[model samples]
Target: MKVMVQPVVRLLLSVPLCVLVACGSGQEPSPKQTLPLLPKDEVLLAADSSKRAMIVEQVLGFELAPVMESVAGKIAYDETVTARISAPVTGRIVSPLPALGSKVNGGDPLVELDSPELGKAKQGYANALADARLAQGAYERAKSLFEHGVLPHKELQEAENALTHARDDVSQGLMHLHNLGVEDEKIDNRYWVRSPIAGVITERHVNPGLEVRPDLAEPLFVVSDLSRLWVYMNVFEKDIGLIHVGTEVSVTVVAYPNEHFPAVVEYIDKLVDEQTRSIRVRCRILNAQGQLLPAMFASVDVRSGPENKAVVIPLTALFTEGEGDQVFVKLGDGHYKQREVKVRLRMKDRAVIAEGLEAGETIVTEGALLLRTEEANEQSEIDAP
Candidate 1:
């Protein structure tokens, strides 16, 4: 998974040039009119742009928690078992092919290899063992005769040398037999290549009578263990700082929206993607029902809580300016300045500021975004978007 960022902006702006009437129109403005219409509570904001209602002042700090209090995520597996069991010796497949997804245990006959090379190796090993045994007997007799001065020392040495060569031949022949898949006890008969793991055969490329060569990529079978899986997701580089190894994670796939699986954060990429600017994260999930499959699209939510109080601005205050985020604050005495602020959390639509704001300051929470939009349009290139 990789992280990506796309900025979203919603703003409206207009200019309102207040006319000084010297309080002569004193019929009095409505309370709603005097207070200004916006979204938040305990807030008052003057529109620097058009008088159209856009911003709202409110008390922030709220969480959108479901009554169930559970996070939804998708399924994932980390360790995937894949192997192409090739013939170690040129051979003919003598066993029927295992069906795809067939379960196998260790030492189970996946298929038997009957090769001319195997028969030759077995015959050679038997002959070498016989020759070595006979040579050993002659060597022992000759050494005894030499010790009794009944035979020449050179003749005895020749017998011993013959025995040594025979022993070497025997050892090499046994190794060749082993390489041909002849277990020591089965060196006398042809045998099968059994499963190396307790898993299912995911692929079978060869069947009975299929002539396979040692030089060929000749795959006989493929196996995989699906008892557990891995789920991966991407986090924005800005959010990566909060994630750590062993963090609890939950995932839910689109195919199974009602079920959420649990997993532990196993790995978080150290580097951010150059194009997406997101960090990759991986979590290992154990399958209790063996339900997850490969390449399934999933949604993962990482729990990042322990909330803290932060300066929040009115949602109405932020106006989309080109591709940037901007907010207007009522600085003082009817003057409002558009400022840059990074939003962190949102409570009841009030955006908690991650940066660019101080505590207890009056910000144009309602209609501020519109005001900023109007300013940017009026100032055009003069103001940063």
Candidate 2:
């Protein structure tokens, strides 16, 4: 009888356990569903208008900004003001060469050459002068005789023709000597290499007793006016159209990185370099202080177009997203929108906007990354279950 009672008790306990399980199952909660976050082009800031003002700064608009193109360049001599001093006649260098960096005046003798050819030319000139004098005397005597009816008119005319021919010979010989740098009053065998322009001797290749020739590949001296300089820039073919004569340019050199030299575009090559596919542009710069030197590496900024009103902003305000550049613009209150902008030019600390921005729109100068971080957090939260 006791065993039968134990079995009935166990059955009652099992039935109660099944009813408890059913009740617990009915009270279970369903999985929570979340809403999607804001789109990538937008973000909502947690800060209010007043707080945002403290965190970031904004400007209403910008004035006209110059559009510029930067290119690598090198400083060079202004060819218009530069001279390559070479031996005018084939000879040996007789005099001491002008020291490098020496200031010279126009027509100052820099190198004296003892040229046998020059000596011969002088001798020929002297002989021609003597012949001319003899011819003139004969012509004068013939004219006088003809006037007194002592000589025939035809004879006097022949004498005049001879005199003219002799004078022409004398002129030709004297011109030859003059071309050799021989003075009329001081005709000598030595040929003086004179500076064509007043400048400093930038280079010297000749020494005393060195043989130099008119056709020498290397110049004896290079004289340049250091008061002016030239910068040669390799402008891309696409930007060649913007570079024209008289365009304003600013140049910076490694020696004076903080200083910007003012210059003007003086020339542009008609042909493009086949290897670089770039056109050569030349800019003339004033070097009154003589600080700029040739062969110095330089950075050239060529002002392409006229100054126009553009949406300019600090470079710090820009952010890169994948292949595009973006900036956060304050919409109103605590809202911000990520805008894709066309960067026309990027300076050291400023950016010139070409599109996707207007004059009156306010931008986030600071706390932009905070807004972006908020956007990412929202996305992650929406993805979480």
Candidate 3:
């Protein structure tokens, strides 16, 4: 009995010791433990607080119709100083074509042509001159005969009439040769096409040995003074009243966007385009550096002048709420309130505030929609059950 009791006691003690050892080994923790909790994102002025920084505000200010009428324009050669040269008569182009971009003075020969039409003109002139000389000598002889009563009055009268007709023919022929660009000293079939204005040859469509005509659809050469250019912009009929001759404007081209070229309204078309319902306005640009090229698309800003001053804001700031125009006015830190405003004129990327806005007031220029969303959310939460 004692031996049995001793064995049971030893088993009981070893079991407790085993339990203690198991607990101590388990203290070395498993690999998949619970991670620490991260702090919550701070609540900004909006639901997505991170986007609150994107909301921008600007103080209202009065400007000369800050909403400039921006329109698409195209750069073109100033017609006042541009020339399109074509063949004066039917001809075949000779050697030595006009160099593209080469500067030329008025009356400078661009290309020489070998023309059969020119030859006929010169021949006709020569024939008329010979007939005139013969007619003059014949009239002198007939007059001498009549004065001596040797020739009949009718015959002398006929001779005088013949001389007059011959002289008239010579005059007409000489005029025709001059029109063909034939010099009196050098009458030939070689016609030299000359430039009528001083300019650089901007374009050339003629090549050696090519036949040219007077009524070619496209000119053979386009000579333009690149130092000055014109910008043609179309203004809507509603805006035409604000623009007129001498109105100052700003111009920008894709190649030089950072530079604002100053220009003035030179001419406004008398009639509005029936299709576009817009009047064409031409502005003169002085491109002394030759940076601007013809046919380049440009942006033109026609200021409203000092007479149309008003508070202006970016178009992004103006939002439609109900039937009225609204904008977000920043009152305090991270707080914006919507205000109904009256828009006098809306233009590209901007608007003129006629009422409900004042100078020096801070208004949201961007991200107004975000503020509106935040406001709607707050109101929704308030009405939640």
Tens-digit lDDT track for model 1 on 1-385? 8644333221112112122354455687666423333332112234463464444544434332211122323444344554557777777777677788888886677877777777777888888999999999999999999999999999998999999999999999988766665776444435577776677776677756988776776567766677777777877777676668987666777767789777778888888899988878888887768777766877665554435445545565665665756776665544567667776654343465677777666666666645555554445433335
lDDT tens digits, residue span 86-134, model 2: 8778899888766799999999988788888787888888888899999
Q: What is each predicted model's overall lDDT from 0 to 1?
A: 0.66, 0.83, 0.85
lDDT of 3 by residue, 28-104 (tens): 65697432221121112734478778888899878767434689999998999998888889999886987788999
- All candidates: TM-score: 0.56, 0.70, 0.70
Best by lDDT: 3
Clashes of each: 29, 0, 0
Model 2: residues with Cα > 4 Å off, grouped in runs? 1-69, 304-306, 309-317, 322-342, 346-350, 354-385
Off by over 4 Å in 3: 1-61, 66-69, 228-230, 235-249, 262-286, 319-341, 356-364, 367-385
**Residue 155, candidate 2: how far off, in angstroms?**
3.2
* RMSD (Å) per prediction: 20.1, 9.5, 8.0
Clash list (residue pairs), candidate 3: none
Candidate 1, residue 172: lDDT: 97
